[model samples]
Target chain A: MFRKYRKKSPWILHYNAGSCNGCDIEILAALAPKYDLERFGVINTGNPKQSDIFLVTGPVTFRSRERLVELYTQMPEPKVVIALGSCTCTGGVFRDMYNVEDGIDRYIPVDVYVPGCAASPELLIDGVVKALEILEEKTKAIEKPFRLFKEASSENGIINRRHSALKVGEKDEED
Target chain B: MSKKTIHIPLGSQHISLLEPVRFKFECENEKIVGVDSDVGFVHRGIERACTTKFKFDAIGYVVARVCGLCAITHSLSYTVAIEKLLGGEISKKAKYLRILLLELDRIHSHMLCLSHTCENAGFEAMFMRIMGDRELVMEIQELLTGNRIQFDYISIGGVNRDLDVQTAKKIIENLALVKAKVFSYIDEFTNNWSLSLKFKGIGALTLEDAYRFNAIGPLARACGLPIDVRNEIEYLPFDEVGFKMQTHNDGDINARNMVRLNEILNSLEMCENILRGLPEGEIFTKLKGKPKGEALMRFEAPRGELMYYVKGDGSAMLNRVRIKTPTFACIPAFSHIFMGEEYADAPAILASFDPCLSCTAK
Candidate 1:
């Protein structure tokens, strides 16, 4: 029952990794009164540590990939990642771009893939709700001292690990 | 608040704008002190790719995508440039049809600018009203060219489609109604005391400033400088299809809007005149010989003068192609105009130029 309450309210953090702003606007529109993703309890939170989900847009540019990994790792464990837009899922139209490395999944593991030059707001809200369902299943398994475990780990070490992981991730993908 | 300079970077990607361009804003206490802009983001090397990648006949289709709002204009200009280079002339009727389509595009571009500007201002109702009225122009464009926005009508030698009698009659009726409705909107916008306050003194660029910065289109026209390439370099049917040039002495956001609005009205008149005097002949003059050597061409787009320099190298494939869009000419003017304005007006001020970063970047 307690896990159900936690599952109902998942915090999301928004990231832009060098897009044309089409997806960014759609993201904003998804949060607006018209779409109202808030009804699904998918709230936008400022701090990454508190975030249960990460919503990333754009085709991870060469410079932004490092920052994106840092941000993704800062979120607590049992976190879900939603790669929003075709740019994030597979680099979309910006694929094979000179400066852009590839998609968001090149740096971080994505839980849900929302595709479109920009996925519509309604579709985005649906993807967020689906991510919350995944988080609930994990919450029930690790019930003991969950809040304590989250507080114990320092954000800095998580960031360093992410950087190293990204380096290894890139090499592995290239190989 | 202390007078401290804060450097805030905007764009490369922006919330309210489309097209990728970087803007570095130097702000002092929430007021913009200076704006530095860079528009070279999506440079596809289309001009370079065009000559080498695309054949001369097919280059018109590629150039049409250079700017979605002025697709037909770019295609027309490219075709005309090639036509002149080949010493080939289009039918008198084809020339008038080109003018009619071009005027419709002008209406499409101007109404879109006004509607989008209103949208940025949070006036959704006014935006929709302008957009709804703009459908008439789109309908005419579609009727003539079979596409709403990207009209793939202009071929190398002439137009691909002809204006039927019913379509031409509908265009005349639609244009008159659109003009009247646009004038009513203009009247409301001009008389709305608050809109005047928001626009009159904002984003001011003097005539000398515009000339020095090489501002083009309504940006220069707003400052009472009659520097239209159409007038400077004459085209067929321009003298016969009489239309008045609109100018304003004050180079503010309002002046720019007024110039665009007035220009749309004149374009409608030009369209009507072209239809009345459209002559009869074969549409295309056949290209028998290969285009050899290099040639440069320029045409006045709805935005301003567009230049295309082509080097053929005596082969079917072109050696080089360079294009200079109107927004490229106005980048310096934007940097100058953006200085010493409140940060809140940044989006509004930027949109006033009707800047197409897509064209600038390409």
Candidate 2:
């Protein structure tokens, strides 16, 4: 019951890793009335714990790398990550810059990549739409029950570290 | 009796800030006394990249990456400096087109700053209203320059594209709409009682403080100091294009808003005039030979004065390319204005200054 309502309202946390503010403004423009991404119930929240999706822009600078990881970890389980802009996707123009870390994917897993010099509002909206789907999938995966596996040597029924039955992308049929 | 001072740090990452700028404020009973700012978070070594990675001709587009809001100004200033070093003269039409885009850029940037100021002051409706109307200018920029944020329109010799009649009409239509919105905003910013409480006499910067700290752009203009780069630069023909300087006397948040609004009006007039009487000539001029000597170019970016100092060695690689961005220059003034203000008004004060950390750190 809570899952259906939660899917409708996914708050976003925007972090400027090391961008030129092109993507930052584009994100704002997407939220503004012209594009109206908020009509889909997306809120640009600042708190990490309350956010369900992360919209990160710019190349991951050396200084922001730690903060990026911290923010990602702070978000609750079953969250989606969207890398907006060319620079954020593959470090586009700022690639090979000494201080830049190529992209945010190096530090956090990205579910969607919105590619553009500044990622136009249309592209950003598309990426967010794609992210909503991924968020739903992750939520379902988290809710699925799993059976613990027994170790050959350990006495308890706790899942063995090496022989755990719950693989991330492995389908239920794999069992 | 002296009260105990408390230390408060705002951001390295905060919702109020669009960029990563940290300020450690020393406050005595809700009154801020001292401010220490760290603006290096967005530094990606663009200066190093300019000298080591990009070549002379390509550096124009590369420098445009310095700040997205003033990307055209960055490229135009660098391209002009390179042209000066190479002894190349661009056509008259190209000059007018460059000013058209530059003024449009100024209009968008000021709108963003004003809307951001409203957001910081807890005026969500005002913020959204300004942002929604700002799209009109952004649409004009897209129609004219082909891209919204990073329009690499100005090449070394001239511009990359020419203005068409349809785009000209679109720009005129949009500018009229934007002008009306800006007028309403001016009235709201002045007459709205709640806004006046938040803005008037808050984050006040006196003319003396503006001079002592050497504030630039709207900040200095608000203090009634007449120091606009457009007035000084002759190569760009800002005067011929109907460019006017907007200055106010109070030097508070309200005064800065007035300066920005007036400047937007002037820029709209300049844009309309450029389209109306645009010269029929070549959009670009082909220049020969490599840049050998040193050249400095200064232009009025939306924020303030943007200076580009380039030293060429008659080679593909440049010797030194120094960009003195306006926000970086006003770091002293920004800190000075924060002193003695109420701690609660810190965000609004910071926003009204229109601080660009990406430009500053770059």
Candidate 3:
């Protein structure tokens, strides 16, 4: 029931691991009246707990790695992570720098990768739109039954059932 | 009654902040007593990368990535330093075009700061309005340069793009619209009650404190400290293009806003002058020889004075590259201003200062 409403207003949490402020400003521009990302029901919230999408910019610096993971963990399940900018995806310019940790994907699993030195507002909006669809899919997947069928088991009951159910769900999803 | 102080941390990742910078504020009740800031969150070791990773010619674009807002200033300062090392003179038209982009960058950066300040003050409508109007400047910038944020406009010897009649006309039209919007903003900023409550005398730095702390840019100018790099530097012809110093005596958040607004007016005038009387010449000048010896260049970024020192040994690679960013210079002043202000006003105060951490850390 709440899953339908979840897709309508998916709040975003933006974290700059080590960006040059180019992509960050572009994110603001996307939120502003010009691009109007809010029309798609996106609100940039500071708290990770309240956010549905984690929009991260910049390659993860060594010092920021812990904070990035903490933020990712703090976010609720069925979250979509969008790596916004070339640096965050593959550490474009700042790659292989002494202080930088290359791309953020080394630490957090990224769902969508938006590439640009400072990804434009148009690209950011597209990324966010794609994130919404992913968020909805994840939401549906989470709400699905963990055990599809009740199989007769003697020893170690329900231990291997979770893995079997996950495999079945994966096969069904592929179909 | 016992007085107790609480340690409150602002960022690393706060919605108010554009970049990642953490500030640990020691507060007693509502008043802030001490402040410690960490700006290394965005540090990507660009200075070392400039010397080792990239060649001298490509460093202009590399340094531009230091801060998106002041990308042009970073490239311009570095390119000017290299040009100085090579001892080659660029055309008068290219110089004027450089100034045109620089002033345009300042206008948009200040507008972004102003809108951010409004947002911090809990005036969401004003933030949206200012942001909406700022697009006029951004539109012209995109029209002038290929990209919106990272305008790799300034290259070695000359700019990457040339100004045409259609683009110049469009820029003039946008400037006229933005100028009118800025005037209305000035009126609203001065007379608005809520803004005055948050801005007037809040987070103020006295003239003496400004000097003692060695504040630069609008923070210094707000305290009536007449230090502007554009007026001092001869690398670019800022003086010929209607440059004026804007200063205020209050040194408060409002004063800084006033100074930035007035500077926008002056910048608009300069852009108009440059477009009207642009000298006719080739935009690019092919200069020979690798950069040798050392050269130091300074330019007034939107935040403050941005200094770049380059040491080359007549090779493709540079021996050393040191960047002294303005926010790094004004750290003392920033901490000092936070000493006596209310803890609740910290975000607004920080916004008014417009501290660009990317520039600082890089």
Interface RMSD of each: 6.8, 0.8, 0.8
- lDDT measured at residue B105 in model 1 versus the true structure, 0 to 100: 83
Q: Give the candidates in order of TM-score, highest first.
A: 3, 2, 1
Ranking by DockQ: 3, 2, 1
Question: For residues B303-354, could you state the per-residue lDDT of candidate 1 as single tens digits?
Answer: 8888887767556777777788998988888999888898888888887788
Q: How do the residues B107-214 of candidate 3 rate in per-residue lDDT, one tens digit apiece?
A: 999999999999998999999999999999999988999889999998899998998899999999999999999999999999999899999999889999999999
Write candidate 2's Cα lDDT for B175-241 as tens digits: 9999999999999998999999999999888999888998999999999999999999889888887
Which ten-residue region of model 1 chain B has the weakest summed lDDT?
A: B12-21
Write candidate 3's Cα lDDT for A101-131 as tens digits: 9998899899999998779899999999999
Best by lDDT: 3
TM-scores for the candidates: 0.73, 0.96, 0.96
The runs of at least 3 residues in candidate 1 whose Cα sits more than 4 Å from the true structure, single-residue gaps closed, are: A1-175
> Best by DockQ, which number?
3
Runs with alpha carbons beyond 4 Å of true place in candidate 2:
A150-175
> CA shift at B154, candidate 3, in angstroms?
1.1
Using Cα atoms, each model's DockQ against the true complex is: 0.07, 0.74, 0.80
Q: Considering just chain B, what TM-score does every model have?
A: 0.96, 0.98, 0.99
